[model samples]
Target: MRTQQFSRTARSLVAAACALTCLAAEAAAIKIQSRDPAGFGFNDPTPAAPVGGNTGTTLGEQRMNVYRYVADIWEKNLDSDVEIVVSAGWEPLACTATSATLGSAAAWNVWRDFENGKPGTWYPQALANKLAGENLSNGQPDDGTGYGNVDIKTQFNINLGQPNCLAGSGFYLGLDGNAGDAVNFAATLLHELGHGLGFSVVSVQTSTGYRLNASATAYSPTGLPSIWEGFMYDNTARKSWLEMTATERRQSAINPLQLAWTGPNAVAGAAITLAPLPVVKATSPAGAVPTTPYTASSFGPAVPRSGKLGVLATITAQAGELGPGCSPFDAANAAAVRGKVPIINRGGCTFAEKVKNAQNAGAVGVVLANNVAGSFAPGGADPTVTIPSVGVLQEDGERLKAAVAAAKAYGSRTQPGAVTASFAIDPNRKAGADLAGRPLLYTPNPLIGGSSVSHWDVSAVPNLLMEPNISDDLTLSVSPPKDLTLPLLKDLGW
Candidate 1:
């Protein structure tokens, strides 16, 4: 989508740091420009009882209250003199019985060559105006969309939580952090707003690896970079996105765990907020692998450091089973897996389903092997899955299968087991970060549009508010020690 273009109005502004310092002296004013018609979106008149520190008596009023509340949080964290306007509304976005698009937001415009902006680098409209100390969004004719004066554009799903539309997962518009089974509307809003305010790539296409031209209306071979790209460092290319070519940036987008944010503020915040990563340590069967990093499943209990070690049992397909362990194990397979940790292949069922099957079979823990070649974090909610579960790379799974087969063939594999493993935390390395402690950006093998390079990697411990998926345990805080959103904004010159 093209960012709305505006004719830049001349303004005298100080240098970058001094401009930011001057703006940081006062609180910002965030204005929500309602895009919906009357009696709709923020104007709906449906009656609603007060709940969770929100006093609005109508549905739309409650929604607006949450918007203003989240806006106040960002306003306090950001510094600006000109009113930061966000064009927002509620609409029927994409939804299904189990999943839905909660909302989407991005900069309504991008600017470059401004008084305080880095030369040839794009800045989001709101931040651009703040740095330049003038409203560049004004004095533009409505290109028929009525978004000429807006700095950001956002929308949410109005039909969320309804039947057939992510049924039972509607937005909970409460100030309290008790979302229960419902989605926390406040946290979701805060995350999307973070993107609009500056936590997003302005005009780079992940699929094609092409950057947007100065006008941002089409892809260009020689395109200007955004301020966000200045911090993206690719270990494979040994260069930052600012120093790499378009093809190199495209290749780095799928480099997985090699693409990291180099922003000092965010890197520092990660040291405070992130924890050591969880891994599987093969402790038995001499010559077994030492340590293998794994992605913890969202469905099961966290992998503990000790007390759960056992033989690494490999599952065989049984009669009536979908795949390896897609269904309940038979007598023989269950017996072999009993009191052991079963390594199941991914597919034919949900991660929760496989882990639940393992738990029911008396397994101490579960290791999920990827069907594909790259890394992935499994996500699903299952309270019955009490066992610790983690996913390993495809190559690791193949090695485990070979080792199990070879060991079981020999008599020495009987007593202490062919392979024994347990989960452990590598205190030397941080979760979701590189060796230097820089937080990894989301860069899966196949690109996920709007999620691939724009958000933090999902493996982050403590579950950041901007990690593509929303965790129910998120709080209102957006600064360091609790979150890294504000620090990243600071890196973007907020």
Candidate 2:
């Protein structure tokens, strides 16, 4: 995290260029180089007509679509009036040239090798050379050009990899429609481009000063200290503008680091649509004798003593600390006494096994909490399991455990006992409903109806290996947008 400032010599050079350019009256140009190889899948067949329909859209078109999506968000949210100029061909040049070397496969390969081994290592000389190839900027061998430029390069590469692009960042996007498909291109691109647009700021914080590194910046978006994390954890504090509190003010503020793009009165733009979760209905007999006594301390108030409550019974198997084998008359029995909610510890077997066990015993609902210390944020329930279940924290589990202990200490005198409990389920709880209508928003779970976060939820993993529950997978990581702001509307003439 070394902070490298622009050198005096570079400043002098820029001054000289400005003086010379004044006489020529030349405008500084923002160039976009679109590299489309012949016969590549991204090329449009007609070239003249707008690319539409499934077949006519090429790989490049998909990538462009993603860019448009991002641009739309930036314009509506950030109010940036910048114009984008797109150029497509074999190779297009943009700026200053500092290196003498032309194109060389060996050079590209060597650079790739160095980059792959350690993604974060910054080589000023190599970067200056690479920039020379693109004519973006100029630098000397020992001048310490730094990574601000490298951040831009990494962003460009990510854009190229659009759909089936490469895993990390090295693999170039292929026009071969066979390798990369257009599925999820819009969301994935928006997420990655977010990295390109100053989302990396959260990674380097200061006790006193800023931490700097090109890789740190490049890796920032998909990494943590994410805007989403900040908003979720700091909801009450208003520390992040992305939360509901700052939603209106975000649009007027120009700073990219602020949470919301506009203030509370501003529109949140289109809401991010999500898929729906699967529905599971309760199915069990309607009446059974109480295996345990009913009490408010033993079960929640929602549980009923008769009807759907007592008729349903669920059986489960507990292993590890609770000991192994199935328990037919344990937690499920407690739930049946009141007719609807059963609590179980999470360990020993798969969620499917636990659900099947409960189903066999005729229970209608299940609540499973972590057996370990801390919160029960272990992950999600198995998607295939049909029973509706939610997780409780370890503290809740401990409360039940303590009640059981007290019941044993009291002997059999206590009717229904302190350990009595019931099962309860809700069929219509929607995911992300907490912040669904707000300007700044996020989904806590990946699958709409499923219980966990999917690999595709974030933009860092290899596109090919993405799957549901990838958030729990150690291989994947998430990068969140940092403080994002839009300048005062008047400044941008809107």
Candidate 3:
């Protein structure tokens, strides 16, 4: 989807030095053990050891802060009540400490393995054993038992050595080189923890030894079988549930899900949802001579002159063509409502420009159809453009074009200079109405009230990278242990 990039105001604050030891009690909530005895590592500590004869700022405390923040966000989002333990001693089992003598290239290689592919041949087994030991000791499932005993590990190889990583991760946030930017360490940690809590790619073994995978799915612990099973079957059906969870979490942070514009920290009011443009149908015979003129009301649903629905309008355009609203008004079709909806050829200019031109022409809505054979881009609408819009298949546009040509040959001359077209709106389309500048309201829920949890402030660490737009980027994997009843499957068919 095309998203509008907007500049946001920057906020700054001087970070007060506080002893890391002071947070030890809080860290215990996440099962994180602190190496700093006096918490001096954060507030005041001995000078760091020199690297290449240069000393770098100690990041131990900042790293711990990130852990705390992640735990807090997770606690807030999860439906179940569970305690999260963030510990410094829990070394990333997937990564190995590199020797000081290794060059940057070698260090990067070590990091790259963690991000793209599975762990080394020895690592998974060893890690599984370690986790099994921990679980068994805690009276949980041991290795080769239930799915819960399985340890699935994936790496996020963020390049901390690069400035982009720092900026993207929101670690080195402010102009003064201080922390506390809106996209701060805490936010990054929250995102990463999202991955840890079943928000990454997942697969399940099937009875036929095949695997089913869906690019996107919802998160559900109940759907997933125990980890002890080997080899996923029918993986094609797997969906990324993690992505949905992340989106919900991010939305919750920025705005309330129930109330569109009522987010505690929303930058704008509730957004408007516009409908798709009406299509024009042909009324004449094929290959007939042009004899009629197009009129403004020839298309589907007349533009509402008043009332709530009147606040929005839609105009369809040919695939890879300019939208009806964006196309320049054609004098040859003077009576035609060309400017009302500019239907230019598609697949050239960006959707942003198309929507911009339509908005410029006093159009409140626009639609772009595909010119070629392909699915519309997911989330195709530009995020920056608040106006409601959608895309149609190229075949559908061609059919409409044929209908218009037939109408012209039928001598249905309403006007020589007028343009008229109409098409039906799909009844099953997702329902959303446009209401700009409106307030969204929701009732209070007594079952779950407001509460706060640990908040960690993360910092850049050497050779690690954090995912961007954590809200929508993460994905989850889930599968049923056995074939579900046909009735159940049909009832939940998506």
TM-score against native, each model: 0.92, 0.38, 0.34
Compare the candidates by lDDT and give the number of the best one.
Answer: 1
TM-score between candidate 3 and the true structure: 0.34
| Clashes by residue pair, model 1 | none
Q: Report lDDT per candidate.
A: 0.82, 0.29, 0.27
The sequence of per-residue lDDT tens digits that candidate 2 reaches over residues 1-494 is: 22222211111001011111122111222223444655542443434223332232455565454445444554444322232222223222221221111100000101111211123322122222222223222341322433222323222332232233332222212222222222233333333333333322222222211222333343322222221122222233354422322332222121111122222211121121211211222321222212221111111122232333322222244343232112434554545523344556667655445544554555555555555432222332344444444444445544544444444444455433333344432223211222332222212211132111111221111111122221211211121111112211111111
Candidate 3 lDDT, 390-429, residue by residue in tens: 3444555555454444444444466322224333342222
Off by over 4 Å in 3: 1-67, 76-195, 199-201, 204-337, 343-349, 358-364, 370-388, 392-494
Clashes of each: 0, 51, 83
Give each prediction's root-mean-square deviation over alpha carbons: 3.1, 16.1, 19.2
CA lDDT, candidate 3, residue 379: 27
Model 1 gets an lDDT of 0.82
